[model samples]
Target chain A: MNRETAFNLVLAAVLLAAPVIAFAANEPFYVALATRIAILALAAAGLNLALGFGGLVSFGHAAFFGIGGYVAGIFASHAMYSEPLPFGLPATDQMPVIWLVAALLCALAALPIGAISLRTTGVYFIMITLAFAQMIYYFAISWPAYGGEDGLSIPVRNSFVGLNTANALHFFLICYAVLMAALALTWRIRDSRFGMALQAARQNEVRLAAVGIRPFRIRLTAFVLSAVLTGLAGALFADLNRFASPSMMSWHMSGELIVLVILGGTGRLFGPVAGAILYVLLEYALGGMTERWQLFLGLILLGVVLFARGGVVGLVAGKARYD
Target chain B: MTEPVIEIHNLAKSFGGLRATDDVSLTLRRGEIHALIGPNGAGKSTLIHQICGTLMPDSGSIRLLGQDITTLDAAARAQLGLGRTFQISSLAPDFSVLRNVMLAVQGRQRSSFRFFGNVMADRSLTDPAMKALSQVGLETRAAIPASELSHGERRQLEIAIALALGSKALLLDEPMAGMGKDGSRALTDLLDVLRRDTPILLVEHDMDAVFALADRISVLVYGRIVASGSVAEIRENPEVRAAYLGARP
Candidate 1:
């Protein structure tokens, strides 16, 4: 196996072993921490598809993440009150159902957003995405139906058939499973015909156009797919915390996702997972030492950008053969 | 003779007040190399752009395989089998040489939307791409990244891409711009062989390569075709010599 595949295998094994060891050791908090890593990794992997492979520097991905969070929150809230939605749609709290709805909604939202924002590129593209996310963020705060700024709480965690999701270890396993499946999907896409086109669009748009593959369409498809993955991660995130807030849709959340992608290694299969682990560990460790932990994180990010253009995975695995 | 694969009629383009390509016209017929030779700033590139659908002509129609494609965009024109190589090499630098040509094969096949199949192992793409590479004598260098290739090899790769597209006609811009004597000679040989099946509209400043290979020659001077005839006729025309070839060393 290649070094990247080997490294990914080890990373996956360590993640799986982390929660199992935590459960055996009765460290429920660590299980929750591990779950947070997996969910964040999943979200960052979504951004990686656009940012890393497609060269779309989106700063509005939180809009999809928030959409996914709210989907879970609204469904669970309606189920609690035994009230049908505005369209007379019955509410449900099943994890798979929530995931499907979240993915669909995110895809729908991304279509228009991608179509408009893809017209501009570079910093303008980044600003347009940031602007879209801010619009969604303010709308969520002002709407107030789902507790507005205060957010909605899930009194009971969403149900999964044959699984006791209320248990911290079992919930971590669920998130881990979802993260693995998403990564596998990512792996498949990275080597597919579509993947070749997306990377070509990123590298040289004129060449792609000359070859008769529309760069705009390739990028739009990637943008929408990326949004769908991030949205699903958001649903899982909300269920993990038993809460969904407007904060989930904030610009800082979008920035954090970008940070995670860069930190792990852009375009590397296991980069986001490695990045999420490092980010969470640093946040927890540094947050305990002082409140201004972000200052340190910023310095580290600078170092990575200046010295390690390939990020953590690049450092460990070497440059990708084709990249 | 076979019908002309591409026909440009009364093509004109302007940039502000300066006429870039004024009333330019050309044609590429089967089994022929149509060479467009000119001094720098003579509007050859502009004329080429109009033909490839990168720049819209103010008034003209371009018929490719007898279909009017004057209004089509670059990608649409390319999809209609109008393939071109850039004056400056524009390639996916990160991709392997094989993958670059496979992208062209994929473009020709119009199956870039396939998301599940591993493109590296897909024989449908690889077979055609490999064949194109071999046509250009680049099959052995297929596994290396395109960025690592020497300048001449990038030119060959671009031809391989155009070949893999199954181009009805080719618009090659400055294919031997920065090449040694041997490099240009090898390319001249390749183009001569390529013209047997696919018609070429070659835009080149290399007069040796142009005179040696052109089945028909057109000389453009200051946005107009100053002379058009067989290679022998153009060589004998004093006006063509005075305007272009005579002035060149």
Candidate 2:
């Protein structure tokens, strides 16, 4: 690994592990907060693959996030009450199974979305991806099943391979493990052969073609992989809250995903996670300081975009030059 | 001893009412450096575009090793061993010189679907890529990011990337468009060695480099071939003199 990328990953791991290290045996609230950070980070991490690595600014990741959330909500509710699944596999509150279904569903949805969106680049790509998200958003709103706009309620969180997913601290540990694994996986791809091509296409597509590599196929594959990972996070998120709603898939959720990447750092593997931690904490801290914290949050985010070219990692790592 | 490696016959293309290429035909046998020289807007870039699959012709055919590829897209034609170099140095600025070439090598080998693992971990992609860079005398700079390379080095790296793709025929568009005398001479020397292994269709504006490196020459003017022959024959052709060489200062 390049020194910069390796250093950035190391720094992100420390930051992500900080909360757990400080409060490993903490109060339930602390565990919940750490859990929230990992889940949100996972969603943003998926977005990072497309937005940071591939240069595809997808404003529809919330669809994957919400789709993942609904998988948990829908499955947990049925399994708790012994209702059959659409596929007749018997509803599962198992996190692994829920993650699988959500990934497959999100990837399948992203295939057509990517096919259409990849046709256009720049402003057209941005607008088309946003439009696809809005379509899904409206579908969730119009559908009356599972509470329509109100959302679905998970009676209990999903189970895991062990009983560790039951306790708050244990559940937080599972999410943290998954988050770390995802971070490693993402870091590996960034340095991989395909990753080189993806980054190259982002830099100079015409040049890539002269080298005999087609940019279109390369980017489309990255886009799908991004959707799958982001979708997995969505399932975990629904279980954490015991809820699934249109709010999870709204344009705001998409915006929040981008915000997380920008808040931490773009292109850095830990950027989204750092952004997630800082964002949730900011919301929590500022929410306590004042009721109208959103106004201050907007100002802070604006300050970041205007003054901080790199995100939190950039600030911490002294302007990392990672590929 | 053999049919030409590349042949374009009666290739015609027009945008609206203006003919960009009018019945342009050429042949490049194996191991020959064929130079195409023309003034600005003489349809030289257009011809390169058609050959590289960036633009489609209105009619006629292109054959690589006697296999027709008139309608194939850029990537398909590339798969058939047609490599290209652009006028603008197109490369991944953030990637290392070696990784840039490795992506091309990866394209020629297996598909790029080796997701989840680091491609850097795969020696399969980098070994040949390094060999290609070494051939261009850029192996020492392999670790540096492509963005840090000098313009001349980037031009050399661009050719290395094409070499890693294992192309048998090369379509070079103005390798000396912005180079100095020294840089141009270096490129010409490199081209001389490359021509031994690859059939090159050279589109350039440097008269000295063109005259020195080309085994044969074709002069295009106003979307038409005014004259084509040996370098000495082109210099003496009255039609080429009237249409281009003598028309300008």
Candidate 3:
């Protein structure tokens, strides 16, 4: 294997091992932290597909993330109270069913948002996306059905037929498996024909059109797919915390997702994982020391942007083959 | 007479107050290089844009192989075998020379939706891409990124892309802009070979290359075609000499 692939494999092993060791050492809290990294890494991996490979700067991914969380929250709430949904569908406490619904709903939400936002490029694209996410964020806060600004809580952990998800170690393993699947999916897409067209669109839209590939179509697909993955992560995130809140859909959450992707690496496959690990660790380490930890985080971000353009992955694996 | 591969009739475009293209009409026949020559701001690029579907003509009709394609987008027109190179050398800078050509080959095949199969290992894509690169004498530089190539090489790479697209009609806008003497000569020879199957609408300033290769020449000035004829006829036209070729010609 090449250096990058080797580094990625080592990263995957470490992520898996850290959680297992935590479980063995009776540090379920540490296991929860590892789970948070996996879920955030999965969410950032979704964004990386569009941001890094397709060059879409979507500042609205929190919409999808929140949508996923609400899907889990709304369903689990209905299951807990034994109430049919507003649409008259039976509520499901099943994680797989929740994930599927989350993916579908996120895709539905992303289609219109991406279609509108993609019409404008660069700063306009960023603003429109941020605007759409804020729209959803406000909608969730005002809609009191799922507790609104107060959020909804899961009294019991959602079921995963084969395992007791209430167990921290089991839940971490599930999140870890999902993260691996997402990373593999990202790798496959980077090598696929669709991926080629997406990257081509990123590099030169005119050249892509000259070759007969519609940049709009390619980007929309990536955006939608990205939403589905992030949406899935959102469901898992809500389950991990046993709560779904407007905070999940907040603009700050959106910024954090972007931050995670950048901290890891923009286009590198394992970039988000590294970024998530560093971000969570920093939040844990620095947040304990001072309430103003973000100040330090900002300074480190500046360092990465100015000196380490490739982010942590670039530092570890060297420059990407093509740069 | 060769059949016309592309027909642009009564094409006109105005950028606010400026009349960029005024009633420009041209035909690119099968098996010929139809060269478009003009001075600066003479609307040559604008005309190319309209034909390629990037710029919509205020009033015009474009046909590819007798089918009206006036309403299609640039990508649709390309899919219908309308290939073009930009004046500014547009390329996927991070993609390798082979991958750049492979994109065109894949575009022609229209299988960009395949998400699982590895395109690099797919011989169907690499074979045609490699063939086109070899045709343009760039097979040796296949692995190099487009960004790293010299100016002349980028032009060659563009031609390779057009070839890989299997274009029935080709639009080459200043294809030899940065080409050296030998590079231009090699390109002239390549274009001569390419025209045997795909007709070309060439917009160039290199008069020697134009004179050496054009089956027909159209000279534009102030957004109008002042003269259109054979090399000998255009060289002798008094209006063309006075307006463009200058007093010495």
What does the interface RMSD come to for each candidate? 1.3, 2.1, 1.6
The TM-scores of chain A alone, one per candidate, are 0.99, 0.93, 0.99
Could you say which candidate leads in DockQ?
1
Compared with the true structure, what per-residue lDDT tens digits does model 2 show for residues B95-210?
Answer: 78888888888778746666656666668887998999999899999988888999899999989988989998988889998898899989999999999999899998888999
Candidate 3 vs. true structure, TM-score: 0.99
Candidate 2 local lDDT, A1-323, one digit each (tens)? 65456666675566556656656656668778878988899888999999988889898899999899888888988899898988688887778888899999999999999999999999899888889999998898888877788889887788987666668777777787877878888888887767777887888888667666788888988888899888888888888888888899999999999899889888878888879888999999999999998898899889988988787877766554532
lDDT of 1 at A228: 98
Cα lDDT tens digits for candidate 3, A88-171? 999879999999999999999999999999999999999999999999999999999789889999888788989999999999
Q: Rank the candidates by lDDT, best first.
A: 3, 1, 2
Each model's DockQ score: 0.77, 0.56, 0.74
Model 2, docking class: medium
- Model 2 chain A weakest 10-residue run by lDDT: A314-323
Per-residue lDDT over B7-99 for candidate 3, one digit per residue giving the tens place of the 0 to 100 score: 889988898899899888889998989999988889898888888888888998999999999999999999999999999899999889999
Number of the candidate with higher lDDT, 1 or 2: 1
Could you tell me how far off, in angstroms, the CA of residue B44 lies in candidate 3 after the best superposition?
Answer: 0.5
- The DockQ value obtained for model 1 is 0.77
How displaced is residue B126 in candidate 2, in Å? 2.7
Model 2 chain B: ten consecutive residues of lowest lDDT: B110-119
